[model samples]
Target: MTELFDADPQAAIAAYGTEAISDPLDMLSRLTAAAAHTMEAMGKRVNDIEAIRYENKQGGEQIRGEVKLYMQAMAQTGKFLDMLIKSGFEERKIKLDEQTAGMFVTAMQRVCARLELTPEQTVLVGTVVPEVLRGLEA
Candidate 1:
């Protein structure tokens, strides 16, 4: 995973092109791509936390607490990204389609699995994603 850092607006705008900004589908594609990248990055972070525990046995308890905090942060961030993507579609008057939702759910599921979410966490995601998607569809 690329090192997490602040994105340069000029670089993004230039990479996306001025013409793409006016296109809602193109915008959605960009948002989806970003969401996927975040998920992958979160998974890598979770793996990194595990590696840290193995490398620093003296700080196992503190590392575990940090791991829990990281998991919660990632979960919330994932949900926010999900909502942001849905809102982007709704704001653009684009109907949420099965393929788009499926791809998003799959990506999120992978992240949740990587983070080893609790049953309640899993259920919250299972419930919320569909509700948001359904609202977008309606």
Candidate 2:
């Protein structure tokens, strides 16, 4: 890059018959222009790399979320998620009262038995069920 910048100004000055132009000033101008171009290129490359990383990260998170959902469906925890939503927790961000919470536990226990899920299987399903139905909307 230095060699290119060093050669260009000399060639330009000779071609334009501008030796009368101060050699130092002309070279300085070319060097500054080359540095600006290099910085612009470097900035673009940095942006491209950042964009790729962001895209890859988003895709990875999405795939992981989907895989967890698949595991939940296999375990029948998808129904639990639906039951939770249908308990009138879908739109309003309201906390469940103690009575409602008890009912929920009872319902969950019934669902577990109905599905023939062992304690370990119930725990495994509880860990992976999608909190919200993101996949369904898609």
Displacement of the residue 20 alpha carbon in candidate 1, Å: 4.9
In TM-score terms, candidate 1 sits at 0.29
Let me know the TM-score candidate 2 reaches against the reference structure.
0.23
Top candidate by lDDT: 1
lDDT of the structure predicted as candidate 2: 0.54
The clash numbers for all candidates, in the given order, read: 0, 0
Pairs that collide, model 2: none
- Per-residue CA lDDT of model 2 for 28-132, tens digit only, reads 445545555555555455544423222254455232333443344434444444444565543433343566767867887788889999779998766655443
Clashes in predicted model 1: 0
- lDDT, candidate 1, at 36: 68
**TM-score of each model, paired residue for residue:** 0.29, 0.23
Error of 1 at 85 (Å): 6.7
